[model samples]
Target: MTSSNGLSSLGPEGASAAARALSLPAESYGNDERLEAMWAMKAYNHAEVYFNLISSVDPKFLKLTKMDDEIYTKFRETFRDLDIKVLDPELLKSAEAKERWRPFCNCYEGLVEDFNFGTLLRLDCREDYTQDNSIFATRIQFFAVEIARNREGLNDAVFSAKSSKS
Candidate 1:
């Protein structure tokens, strides 16, 4: 899809088109090659915060983590009941699908309101990236999924191995 500035929603190329449309200085746009790297860093920072929160084992977070687990387990059924596409990366590429998923993804309502949905990133969690495993999810989805993983002991092996090394 194209933005109002006539740029394809394909990251750097889109940003370049926006910069040109707005008559922005070349310096202002920085290195286009670095945009994805910067986004990855942002995602990493968010994950770090979530991991720290889970490490603390805060009661509210623990409760939410349990809820996230249940939600993910019943994801397909939830989508069916809501009449939306079941968790597919392709489905999340459109604004309409994002809106459809918004109600179910309201765990972080404040961040959701403030975030740019169009810039949502895809994260592939599998050993190999595939249509079924790669997820085009909002920032909140990453947090929810990771939190659930931590709470359900899925991340224990990694942490335990790390601690063993130390």
Candidate 2:
């Protein structure tokens, strides 16, 4: 698929957004050059798929990944004070948060496919996948934070109002 920006999208080419891929249109970027967020499109795809999943299914029935328990547990252990519903930008951007997140994210390196692939994560569980509320993060970080949000019942807000209206 192609984005409106004229650059061909690296997503939706018969591969799950979670798949491991290191290729990009070399013509567009030259051999080694990369976009600041190489996986933004994929991240957007992932966020949409994930949001739809949570909207349709209750958090208790949601299983984000094979390592859901591990990711959620470790995330909670590492970030005891995290406000999952609306994440602080500093938590994902500051140098210090990265320092604290490195070990935790690396733990799933081999166990989860494409664990380090760049992806977009929504800063607020209640928000849609708008550019303003999204941030770049590794797949594992996305899993960890999103899993925690689902399990904590924070993401129920996604479909709560709509469901009630219906």
| Alpha carbon lDDT at 165, candidate 1 | 62
lDDT of each: 0.45, 0.75
Every model's TM-score: 0.39, 0.78
lDDT of 1 at 114: 27
- Collision pairs in model 1: none
Give the lowest summed-lDDT range of ten residues in model 2: 1-10
**Any idea what lDDT model 1 has?**
0.45
Residues 73-115 of candidate 1 have per-residue lDDT tens digits of: 6454445443121235545557886776676677446534422
Q: Score candidate 1 by TM-score against the native.
A: 0.39
